[model samples]
Target: MADTAAPPTAPKSMAVPLTAFAVGGVVALLLGIFSKVHDPTLDGTTTLGYSNVLAMKTVVAVVIGVLAVGQVIGALWIYGKLPIKAPSWLGKAHRAGGTLVLLLSVFVGYHCLWSVGWETGVTDTGYHVPARTIVHEILGCIVFGAIVVKIVAVRSKRAPGWFLPLAGGLLFTLLIAAVLTSAAYYIGDNGWPSRA
Candidate 1:
C-alpha cells in the first residue's frame, strides 16, 4: 500500500506569518497608545554623562544607523549578493549586530517615551513641534513593530522564504528613516553636539 499523507495547506502555511503580523501590529499599537497617554517628565534627566538627553540620543542614533548599515552589508554578504565571500562567523556577527541595534534602539526609545512622550504638533508651552519630529515619532513606533516582525519571521520554521527578507528590508528601512528624521535632523539643526 502507498502512503497517503497530505501536504501542508495554504492556511497552515500562512499561520506563522499571520501571527507575526498580528503580534507586531499589537505591539506597535500598544507602544503608540502608551506613549500618547504617558505624561512626559524631563526633570533631573541624566544623559549618562553626556551634555544632555538629546545629545545622548543623537549619538546613539548615529551609532544605530551605522550598525544598521553594517547589518545590511552583512546580510547581503550572507545571501551571496556581495562580491566578497562571506566568512563563517558572519552570521554570528550579524546576529550580534542586530542585538546591539535592538539594545541601543530601546535605550533611545525609552528616553524619548519617558522624557518627551509622543508629540503631534503643539506642546503645552505653545511650541510647535517640527514636522520632522512628528514623522520621527510615528516612524519610531513602526520601527519597533518591524523589529518584532523580523524577529518572529526569522525564528519561525514555517515562515515563507520571501518573508524573512521582506521583514528584514522593512526593518532596515524603518531604522534608517527613524535615524534620519531624528538624528540627522538634530545634527543638521543643532550642528552636532560638541560633547557628544
Candidate 2:
C-alpha cells in the first residue's frame, strides 16, 4: 500500500446535541414570548414584580442554542477546508450550549420551588390535574436530568456518540410537549374556563 498519513481526530458526536439545543433555543424563545403575552401571570406582567427572569431565560436559551449551531457549522467548515485532519471545533459550541442549558435548568428549578414555597400564586389555572403539582415536578425533574446527562456525557471520555444529541432532543421534546399541552388546554373546551 502507498504511504498515507492517518487522520488526526475521530468524528465527534456533538452535532446531535447541538441541533437539539438549537431547536430548544428556538422553542424556548417562542415559549417565553407565549408565556409573557398569553399567560399574563409571568413576572413582568404587571407593575410590581419588574422581573427580568423571563427575559434572561430567553436570552440564555438563544445563546446556548446559537452556540450549539455555531459549533456544528464550525466543525463542518473545518472539515471542508482541511479534509485530511481531525475536527478541532467539533464540540466547542456544544460545550458552551450545554453549560448554558445547565444554568437555565438551575434557574427554572429554583423558580419552581420559589413559586411553590412563597405562595406567590405562581400557577395560573390551578393546574387541575390529579395530584395537581405532578406535572410541574415531573417535567422539572426530566428537564434537570436531560441537561445533566447532556453535560456529563459531553464531558466524559466514555460517552457514546449518540448520547449528546439524544439528550438535547429529549429536552426539546419536553418543552414542545408542555407548550402543546398547555395550548390545547387553552383552546379545547374540555371542562376548562375560557380566558376571554
Candidate 3:
C-alpha cells in the first residue's frame, strides 16, 4: 500500500519585512500630517548655545552626514567588502554612532516641525519658497521613515539578509539628500553660522 503525504512548506516568513514597511509608512505619514496641521512658531529654537537655529541645524546635519559616512564604511568592513580588518569593538561603536545620529535627528526634526512647520513653497504674504526648500521638507519626512524601516529590519531575525543592506542604503541616501537640500543649501546661500 502506498501512502500519500503533503510535503512541508518552506519556513520563510514575510511578517518582519511587511511589518517594518507598514510601520515606516505610518511614521512618515504621521509626521507629514502633524507638520501640516500644527501652527508654526517661527520664533526660533535654541540649540547647542547657538542663537541661530538654522545655523545650528545645518551644523548638526553636516555632522550627521559625516557620521553616516562612517557607518557605511563600518558596514562595509563588517561585511568584508572593505580591505581593512574589522575590530571586535566595531559593532558596538557602529550601534553607538547610530543611536547618536537618531537622537540628533530627533532634535533637529523637532525644531523644524515646531518652528518652521511644513513649508508648501507658498506664503500668506506672497513670498515663495525655493524649490530646494520644498524638496528638503519632503526628504526630511522620508528620511525618518527610512530610519524606522532600517531599525526594524536590523532588529528582526526573520528579515531577509538582503533587506538590511537595502534598508541601510536607502536610509543613508535619504539622509544625505536631506542634508544636501537643507544644510548644504543654507551654507551656500547664507554661509556657515548664518545670521539670518
Per-model TM against the reference: 0.90, 0.42, 0.89
In terms of lDDT, model 2 sits at: 0.47
In Å, residue 187's CA in model 3 sits off its true spot by 0.5
Task: List runs of model 2 lying over 4 Å from the truth.
Answer: 1-91, 117-134, 175-196
Positional deviation of 161 in candidate 2, in angstroms? 2.5
Give candidate 2's error at residue 93 in angstroms.
4.0
Q: For this target, which candidate reaches the highest TM-score against the unseen true structure?
A: 1
Q: What tens digits encode model 2's per-residue C-alpha lDDT throughout 37-141?
A: 442334522212323443333333344445445544454454464455545655565456556655755654454434332122345557444432355445544
lDDT of 1 by residue, 1-196 (tens): 9979997654436777788888888888888899999998877465876788998899899999999999999999999998899999999999999999999989998888888889887888899998888889888988888889999878877778888899999999999999999889889988776663
Candidate 3 lDDT by residue in tens digits, 1-196? 7767886654556777788888888898899889999998856577666657788899999999999999999899988899888999999999999999899898889888888888785798888988888888888988888999999878876677788999999999999999999889888987787443
Preferred candidate (TM-score higher): 1 or 2: 1
The lDDT of each candidate is 0.88, 0.47, 0.86
Instruction: Please give the TM-score that candidate 3 achieves against the real structure.
Output: 0.89
